[model samples]
Target: MPVFPKISLRPEVENYLKEGFVNNEVVSASGKAAAERKFEALLNHLSHPPSFTTVRVNTHLASVQHVKELLLDELQQVWQFNGLSVPVLQHPDLQDVLLIPVIGPRKNIKRQQCEAVVGAQCGSAVLRGAHVYTPGIVSASSFMKAGDVISVYSDIKGKCKKGAREFDGTKIFLGNGISTLSRKEIFSGLPRLRGIGIRMTEPIYLSPSFDNVLPSYLFLQNLPSAVVTHVLNPQPGEKILDLCAAPGGKTTHIAALMHDQGEVIALDKIANKVEKIKQNALLLGLNSIKAFCFDGTKALKLDEIEDTEGTPPFSPESFDRILLDAPCSGMGQRPNMACTWTLKEVTSYQPLQRKLFPVAVQLLKPGGTLVYSTCTVTLEENEEQVAWALSTFPCLQLQPQEPQIGGEGMMGAGLSGEQLRQLQRFDPSTTPLRDTDLETLRDARAEDMIRLANKDCIGFFIAKFLKWKSTSEKDPQK
Candidate 1:
């Protein structure tokens, strides 16, 4: 049973998405009937959680086996329910991956006396194994006290005002929980906020919280995000570039993969986001990453004798590899009950992404790798960009990915079937979970977990290209 119905969207957004699925040539070619079915499946799946929860055991600091044992022990202690053991399985393909099935929409959880309203983002996090943080609490019962049992509701429409006495606007029931703080403590004077306001005891979805749980030995990252790092494959002793890198999830992963060897330059347009990158690097103990606040689209050096070792505006062919995880209309994010973006706002990312691509290509050494990826499902952002790139740059050729867990590229961009095969796309709607023996999953290998993790992920696209030896038209190689 689904806990939430297929996320309700504004009429305009719904019509826009429906037209894309019905009239778009790429979707029509997949067979109109099949396309419609897939769209429905996407909607259904979006309202629910993924089949497995992936945790990247920080093997850089702790051994995989050791972390696995510790996590199992912790799960037993934290998630004990009537002496019944909750299964914590290791991923078959990724060595560091740990999988835990979410037990959800519990049959019997009585509504409590007190009520706490949270915003949609906080509600989604609660569904996916996160405890309610202090700031997410929007409104609480006037008489609510510490340890009082309460039922949480998510204000999906984002219309609920903070510190309200009561809310009758739009909201959804999340689950039952116990208040960790009194109403006064949660809504009083400055510096009143100190700790967790609510502790979820009977969440609709049952998954262990990873908060402060083996922070150094494990990172709670989505499976597709992990795949992005592996596909980039940043090697040791090489200089790499990550454009639009913020909050430093992939940036830190790259540095860790390189064993903290060589320079990993990370750039983001926002100054505050750059600070977050540095903070994540410090927390992860990665010293090789150098993050700067600069726009990647304008990262081209015009001077003959520019500073070679500084941030951005670098000379051509400066990096061995570049990752342009460009921003886009994040329609693929799950549990998004509503999106207020206009069509114009949603279609505005392509030009910016295109502007950044050339800089990334010019900054790469001859024979260097450039990976362009996005967490989006739009044709304009994914396949169409690949088509445009191939036609624009004679030196660039789509290269095959090492671990191709996602489906091939979708068909609307005039790319050939073989060309599409070379690209990787993690379309959550297409892949289905396979049932394997319990014992087999328990003793799964690292490669198996990586494979499984790759397939079961958010909608994403990855296109890797290798620059030719030379770009000059008069070259003998040409």
Candidate 2:
């Protein structure tokens, strides 16, 4: 039996995904039955949260051990499970990371009379350790009052109407919590209130809230995300570009990796997202990041070849390293029970990702590195893109990643065995499912626990390429 419902997708969308996983290449390698099983496993894992939460300590500001001790103390203070403590483990390979186990799916809890329905996105957050905010509450019991214990549920199918007295459509229980906002307060016409509307008292999954805990010293990053910068290997005094950097997670990591001594230019198309990048940089006390609001596809400035400092319209081959964290359909986020996107919407990212690749390649200097990544699972977005890039740009050569923690690339994209080995694909479906109860976690060895944390993270893909040919040496495409 599955622990959670397999992530809900439209019939056509689901069929589209099934095709990718059960393709000829995958079936040939693993056999048809095995490929189908893997696809089903991926679906089951998508609706569940990662077993552990990963935080990247800002080594530029504090040592991993210092931050680790501080975090251990903070979590100790917040540890609320019958007084049994959960240990915070540091990664063996990722020196700047700390892992905290997420305990439960707590199936034993009984449902309560009063009910509250949160949006799908908010429900995913709850499973990943977040209180229910007011704005996320779509429906609540008409007579439910503050401080009343209520069973929380997610409108997994998005069929619930706002301010509804009760939702009768498809929904999934997300454990119980105490209401902090009554029905009137939540549905009040004046304005949608912010902050916690339901303080989770018995959440299905228990992970520490990192709202303001060591904000400057800890970044709530996934294990694979922390690996991207290590692959980029940004050096001090060198210039790097992070295209499509919003809220600047990888952008700041690049700056921190360089010891805040080099320029890390980050660009996102949205003004508010650019502001968020700037805000995160300020919050982390990283002074080396320069965020700009500009379209990455049009970032190259070949008309006038000159260094433009850290602004848009940069000359070709200017940045020592470039990171194209291209936007995609986002099929790989964990605890996501539903994706309402159409087939066209799901397939729309390939062209956009292709557009950003040339810009990243052109912006990178000769012998510089370019790392392209996405948080999606499609062959088109991950492995197919790699094959396309190799064919499209003769100057680009796929490079080996430093931390080879994730499995090799998927087999459907015509990439050779060696080429596939060079890529990293964090497929959650590969790991065996196991109980994450507190006792199970406590009894597990440290190495085994860390390994589980790594493979059970969000579905992500990364491919590193080196621009081997110098501008003066050849003009093959030009």
lDDT of each: 0.79, 0.89
For each candidate, give its TM-score against the true structure: 0.90, 0.97
**How much lDDT does candidate 2 score?**
0.89
Model 1 TM-score is 0.90
- Backbone clash count, each prediction separately: 9, 0
Instruction: Name the runs in model 2 displaced over 4 angstroms.
Output: 79-82, 189-192, 305-309, 471-478
Task: In model 1, state the lDDT of residue 407.
Answer: 86
Report the lDDT of model 2 for residue 263. 92
Candidate 2 local lDDT, 302-412, one digit each (tens): 668576765788887889999988999999989889999999999999999988998888888989999988999998899999999999988999999998889999998
Number of the top-ranking candidate, with TM-score as the measure: 2
> Model 2 residue 297 lDDT?
87
lDDT of 2 at 68: 90
- TM-score between model 2 and native: 0.97
